[model samples]
Structures are given as structure tokens and as C-alpha cells.
Target: MEVKVASPSASRRSSQTKKLVGGKRGCHVVVKVFPCKICFRPFTNGTSAHLHARTHLNSAELEKTSLFHAKCPHCQKMFFVHHHLTDHLFVHLSREERAEVAQGWRHGCYFCTKRFRVSSHLNLHLLTHTKEKLGGICHVCRKTFTSKQNLTRHGFAHLSEDEKIALVKQGRSRKCLFCQKKFPDNRAYHVHLVSHTKEKPFRCDHCGALFGLKYNLNKHKLIHSEDPRPFKCDKCDQAFSQKHHMTSHKRTVHRKLKDFACPVCGKKFGRKSHMVGHLRSVHAKIRHPSPHCGKTFTQKGHLGIHLRKLHPSEPSAK
Candidate 1:
């Protein structure tokens, strides 16, 4: 063994094997390793690694350049080139459905129960439910979604804490006019205003029930479909289809945590909506006057009660 000497080829092969096994132990032995700074892909030479790293840098630059291009005025979808964007405008023009396909179209499908920006996009998305090839797949859940937008939204659930925080910060530049509340985006601010107006645009087709939020409409539809209640109460046998309902039940019934306190009456409410309703009934200005006695009340219920008790034969003033 003392007289034996390894050949140059054997020494080179050993070094190659060590470089191939680029773990902590092997990396310590390989002194001349040309590891890529971007992806850490090990290379035989520094020049090769540097060239490979430049490809990633070029891709990042291309993405930045693409973002600098003009976006569609209607859909706000970005275009890498002006000609491609001009061609996209024709799709919006010369159509009866053009009015509905405006900036905040929010096209929804009845079949897959998914929402989209444009009706034509929704039509194309519907084909995915019937065909396998067009289906959008989520890598994290391994589930198939009808549209890419739905899949993107599904991906948000898998985001890291830092990524989620950054995304929240990106959208939080806008503020609400009524409460001066800060929202992440304009869409969120509009949705929040629905609470103040008490406007219920999302309606259930099955039961003819109405909901202010699309999420609530989706949850309400589950009732007609007889979906299983996954979220259960720990103290009682009660279960709910939605997690927020379970949380609400727990806070109101079990925990009894009245977090939302009424500013006018000093009354505590388990939910913010309940507190808002209380404020509207007790503290809000009397807009609807009682035609029976020229008296005004904050709530419609109070006016109805006053009419029924005092002016029963007055034929119920409108």
C-alpha cells in the first residue's frame, strides 16, 4: 500500500464524484467547486457557472421589461408589447357583452361556481370542467381548478408568513371614506362599503336567499347542496359548514367574548356586524319618518311597533 500510487485518471474521477455529491461533507473536500450563485448548480468551471447565472439575470430583466409595457384599460391585464395589447382591444370591441366586460366585470360561472373577469374567459374556463387538458392544476394541493384565477387564489392559502405580509402591504394603500378604515385594495374597500349600505348583491339561486359577500353566498349554497359540516364545536354537538360560523358560535356562546363594543350605548357585541346593526338601530339618524304621528325613530322596527300599538286603525302608514 505504501508503494502504490493513484493514477491521474483515478484522481480526476474521485474529484468528479466528490463534486457530484455536493452535500456538506463532499463540499468540504471539493476545494475548486464552481457553485452557481443563483441556484447553487455546481459546475466544473467558473466561466460556465457565471454564464448559467446570467440566464437567470436575463429572465428577471425580461420580466421587468414586460411589466413596463402598457396594460389593457378594461381588464388591466398587462401586455409585453404595444401591438399585442392593441390586438387584445379588439376582443373588447364590437360585442353586445362589452358593457358587462368592463374593468370590474367579475364574471361568474354557475357550473363550477367560480368567478372571472370576463364572460368570454368564463366560457373558455367552463370547457376545462368538461375537458381534462384545459384544467388548471394547483401544485400545493394537487387539486384541479376550472380557471387559472381560482388556482392562483388557491395558491394564496399556501403562502409563507413573510410572503403573505408582503402581499397584504402591497394592497393596503387605499382607505375607506365612511370609517376611515384602511383596505388592502380598492376591491376590498368596495366590499367593505357594502356593509354600510347593507346591499346584498350575491343571491342564492336555490333558496332565493341574499348575501352581501360572495363568500357568504357560496356558504349559503352549501346548505342547499347538503354539504357536510366539517367545523364542529368543542363544548357542544353543534357544527357549521363554514369555519367563521364556528368561530362566531364559539365567541358568542362559549367564549362569550364581546370584542366589538358599541360606541354610543356602551353595549358589547360578539360580532362587528351585530355592533354595526346596533349602532344603526340605536344611534343612527332617523331617515324614515312615521307618517302616523310625524314622530321619527332610529329603527324601522320601532316605528312599526309605535304604529301597531298607537295607530292600529290608521291603515298602517307607509
Candidate 2:
């Protein structure tokens, strides 16, 4: 899945650049910003990101030299790294549940259910827990938030309450007629308008990917670099190109602790297809019948899959 596109000479890139940047700086590509998946810390290169990732894993991870794979019970997502999986598991638990785990596993590792004999051994295990201390207080408004990003976003509201105003006036009255979203100025208003249309003007010179926004296209171009995956799950030797992808890989594949449940008959399954099959038998009736063959299917997706596989030239549905 690696796609390579030429430099500024490409058609998509030149067209996207003019529509996006709309200025003399259209030729320049977006700057690279590498953020750590675990802590959201930004770094310039993969070596630093890889080095920092080692901090998230316990020393025990190294002693055991074997392949490791973790799967989230709820969504059936898979993760390659142990510490990433452990760090992801907390998001699925409520505050009370998390506190319970922290207390109960205080003398043990909650993620792997591994108990330690010594107090210092348990203390070392705490480093693997990635969830930050929950209560973050805002300096200006004295407001509380769950994470640093929320606090930072909340702080923007108080940027200029009364005393001074920004030189470039924000037209709060300037609203998008189509979506009812407020915009600060004409430039922003026009940018918002692009989302309504099927047009994606922003372009990446390296890969020639199209994006509606310059910000997103610029962010996408970073993937073309030699070392796109700065963040590394050193525990499992897995590398992630994007920080969010790594976080999501951990959260969805590792932290989830329960199999997916069928709403109709209260059946649980590790795979989604199995649950769907359960629904087809108990709740849904076999309605979709094949024209050529005598076989019938309970769902359109199943029938479509059958058609694509067996009858390659036939239309999927009647």
C-alpha cells in the first residue's frame, strides 16, 4: 500500500496548491510535526519518538523475549504491544472502575492480571499506565477538565474577555447560510463553504493526495517522508505512522474487555460476523434468495459477498 507521486510537477498537487494556499507560498509543502502516541508529546524525528516510547513499557517486558499479541474483548481489535494495550484498557473503564483497578491492582498489574510479590515490583508496574491524572485546572477561569487538550481549548474562550480585543476583528455575526456555523472572517467563511461541495482543492505535492483543507493535505504529505512512523511501540517492535493510529490501535484492540453482544437474543461473540450470523438465525429470517443457485441469505451484505465471489459478472442485488 505504498503510493509514490512525483514532486511539484504533478497535476493534482499544482491544482490543489493554488486552491488551498492561494498565495505565493503555494510551492512549499507543509512542515512535519511528529507527536508521540502515548503522551501526545511532539518530536522532530523517529529516533526521539522511539526512545520515548520505551519509557511506557516496564522492565519486565524486555526480560520475556517472546511474541505478544493483545485483543480488545469488546470490539475485537488487535494490538501488537503489551504496554500500549495496557494503557488503552483504562479508557473503557469508568472513573470508579479505574480507581478500583488502581487500588486493587496496587500490588499487582491490572492489565495482564500479573501479581507481584514485592512492593517495589508493583511500583515499577505503574509506569506502564498511560492515563494521565484526571483533574486539570484552568489558570484563568478556575475551571476543571479531564485532559490537558480540553483545558487548552477551554482557555481560548478567555483569551480576551473584556480588556483588549484582537486586531483582526472576529465577525461573530458572520454565519454560514448553509450550515449555520459562525465564522470570524470572509477567508474562513469561504473555506467553510468548500466542505459543502464535492470539491477537494488542497493537494500534497509528494503523494498528490487531495484534501478539502490545506491543514489536512499538509498533514497528509508528511507520510511521504523516509521515516513517517516516528512513534514506535518498542515493546512489540511495531511502528505507527500516525500518533492517533497508534492510540486507536491500542484503545480498540487492547483495552476493550468484553465480546460484542447481539441486541436481539443477548448472545456474545468475539467476531462481528459470528454475532451477525446469530442474529440471522434467531431474529432475522432468510429473505434474500439467489436467482441462479437455490441458496438463500439472511442479509444483503452476505448475499453481496456471495455474488462477488461466485457470480463475478452478475449484479449483486435484484
Most accurate candidate by lDDT: 1
- lDDT of each candidate versus the true structure: 0.59, 0.53
What is the C-alpha lDDT profile of model 1 across 148-181, one tens digit per residue? 7556655775565566666645542334434655
Candidate with maximal TM-score: 1
Per-residue lDDT of 14-118 in model 2, one digit per residue for the tens?
111112233465443433434333333345566775476444334454356784755545323334577656655654554466666776554667676665545
Q: Count the backbone clashes (under 3 Å) in each candidate.
A: 1, 5
Stretches of candidate 2 off by over 4 Å are 1-196, 213-219, 228-230, 256-305, 315-318
> Global lDDT for candidate 2?
0.53
Each prediction's TM-score against the native? 0.33, 0.30
Candidate 2 — which pairs collide? 72-253, 73-258, 74-258, 77-253, 89-255
Summing lDDT over every window of 10 consecutive residues in candidate 1, give the lowest-scoring window: 1-10
